[model samples]
Target: MGRLSTHILDTSNGRPAKGVRIELFALEGDKRHPVATEMTNADGRTDAPLMTGATFRTGTFELLFHVGEYFRSFGAPLSDPPFLDVVPIRFSIAEPDGHYHVPLLVSPWSYSTYRGS
Candidate 1:
């Protein structure tokens, strides 16, 4: 079965980012449809796969990570307007039956992501 999953790491603090809000969206051309909203757990992972089974399909998708709010809660010394607010990672999936792991390594000022196992 195919599935989509994600996790976040607080690069600044060198730990799993817990309680971060993540939003999933499916994109079609100029349209973006809401898919799922999830919160990272203690392990920086969602309780369940964001997309799985029949809902998992091949196409473009976006994962929005609310890192600014998370940093503020932890009292990170961010600027009045943080350099990195809501981080958006957009990518495409070509194989419907392949497991796709998208992990975000983020800080108050920067973030990066890549397709993982």
Candidate 2:
């Protein structure tokens, strides 16, 4: 069975980025449709897979991470307008039954992501 999952790590804090907001979107042509909105738990991961089973498909998608709000909540010293605010990661799924783990390592200043196991 194929599934989509994600997690956030606060590289600056050396811990999971708890309570960050994540928005999922499915892109079709030039339009983006909202799929789901999830928040990171204590482990900096969603409670369940973002997409699975019938809901999971091979197509283009985007994951929007609200890192600015997350840093502010913890009193991180950032400029009036944070350098890295809402981080948008756009990717595509090619296999119908492959697990896609997109994990984000981020901070108020910068961020990175990759296709994990």
Candidate 3:
């Protein structure tokens, strides 16, 4: 069965965005429903996958990162109306039995994500 998991790193600090908020949502039609909410640990990983086992389904999902707050808390200089606010990562799970790794390498001005093995 498929599972949902994520990791968040602070590219600005070259460390895990500890305590950064992460929200998981399952996209249905045009509405997004909350699956779970968690904060990154010292290792930048959630205590558990948002969902796992047979309950996982193939659909679009979103991971909302509180990058603005994360940077501000660390006293990163901003340009008054930061360039990167909340980062929304939208992707689809094509296989229920496949392992999906969506890791976010984020900075104040930019971010990147890909389908990791």
Candidate 4:
């Protein structure tokens, strides 16, 4: 019953971060392997769950959000080294039967995520 999903909210703009690029990586020891890459829709969500059913596993995984590029696309003036560029969220799923709704609330200066329903 477990599934992996994510969404991005652009806190600075008070809207969903549409068209944002997201990457999924499975971690193993010292390195990580790419699982999939996707671009957010108008609602800042993928058309399908990142992982679900049999493909979902109990292990550490990383979700990388390309925030800097997203903001820049809107003509937001950022620092030379943007305050927040690629935001990476690393998490572990111990329950294969649990739902992991990793939602991100982000802005040019900061971001946050949590296990959601």
Give the top-scoring candidate (lDDT).
2
Residue ranges of candidate 1 with Cα displaced over 4 Å:
none
Clashes of each: 0, 0, 1, 0
Ranking of all predicted structures according to lDDT, beginning with the best and ending with the worst: 2, 1, 4, 3
Question: Whole-model Cα lDDT per candidate?
Answer: 0.95, 0.96, 0.86, 0.93
| By TM-score: ranked, best first | 2, 1, 4, 3
- lDDT string, candidate 2, 2-115, tens digits: 999999999999999999999999999999999989999999999999999999999999999999999999799999889989999999999999999999999888899999
Clashing pairs in 1: none
Clashing pairs in 3: 2-96
* Regions more than 4 Å wrong, model 2: none
lDDT of 4 by residue, 36-106 (tens): 89999999999999999888989999999999999999888799899999999999999989999999999
User: Candidate 1 on 1-117: residue-level lDDT in tens?
Assistant: 999999999998999999999999999999999999999999999999999998999999999999999999979999989988899999999998999999999998888898998
lDDT of 3 by residue, 1-102 (tens): 788888888887899888778888999999999988898889888888877896688899999988888889879998789998789999999987888888
How well does each candidate superpose onto the true structure, as a TM-score?
0.98, 0.98, 0.92, 0.97
As a TM-score, model 1 comes out at 0.98
Candidate with more favorable, higher lDDT: 1 or 4: 1
